[model samples]
Target: DHGSQYVSDVFQDEIAFLGIKSSPSYVREPQGNGIAERFVRTLKENLLWVRHFDTVEELRLALLEFKETYNREWIVGRHGYKTPAQVRKEQTAPVSIAA
Candidate 1:
């Protein structure tokens, strides 16, 4: 999806400040882009917007904790109301087939 945030003047200016050359463009799959945009929104909502970290280390620690909590507890309907950890476990679990 073509989210306004990526192309917003403020966002562009922020990236430019960090020496990043960001360009917004269309992708072949519109649906996939929405996933990325939604993730950015979720990350901002859950972690960035709510917390004020004093240092990069503090931010890193918080992000790690957030990731763990998200994967272990956040239930997604697409995964049949299962947490990401459960889905990953099912995916990687050894498959047994009785002969």
Candidate 2:
């Protein structure tokens, strides 16, 4: 689903050309896309709200660090307190091993 920024004509055209389905969440219906909203809130609270960088390079570096830490260290309640990386590893574990 496209967020508010994707309401632009360029984004709509791109999605249309790609044949990707686009659905916008209804106004005042946060539960419709709760995961995305939660992610946005976390990003704002943890990264955007905490720092002010003068240069794009600085911001990029900070964002990279934030993403790495979030994936590797952050314990998400939704995943039973496991980091996202751990959940992905568990999901991809081999069912059978060769002798």
Tell me the spans in candidate 1 whose CA falls farther than 4 Å from its real position: 1-27
- Model 2 residue 52 lDDT score: 98
| Best prediction by lDDT | 2
Q: In angstroms, give how far residue 84 of model 1 lies from its true place.
A: 0.4
lDDT of 1: 0.88
**If scored against the real structure, what TM-score would every candidate get?**
0.68, 0.66
lDDT of each: 0.88, 0.89
Candidate 2, residues 16-72, lDDT tens digits: the string is 999987888777877768888898899999999989999999998999999999999
Error of 2 at 17 (Å): 13
Clash count of each predicted structure: 0, 0
Instruction: Determine which window of 10 residues in candidate 1 has minimal summed lDDT.
Output: 23-32
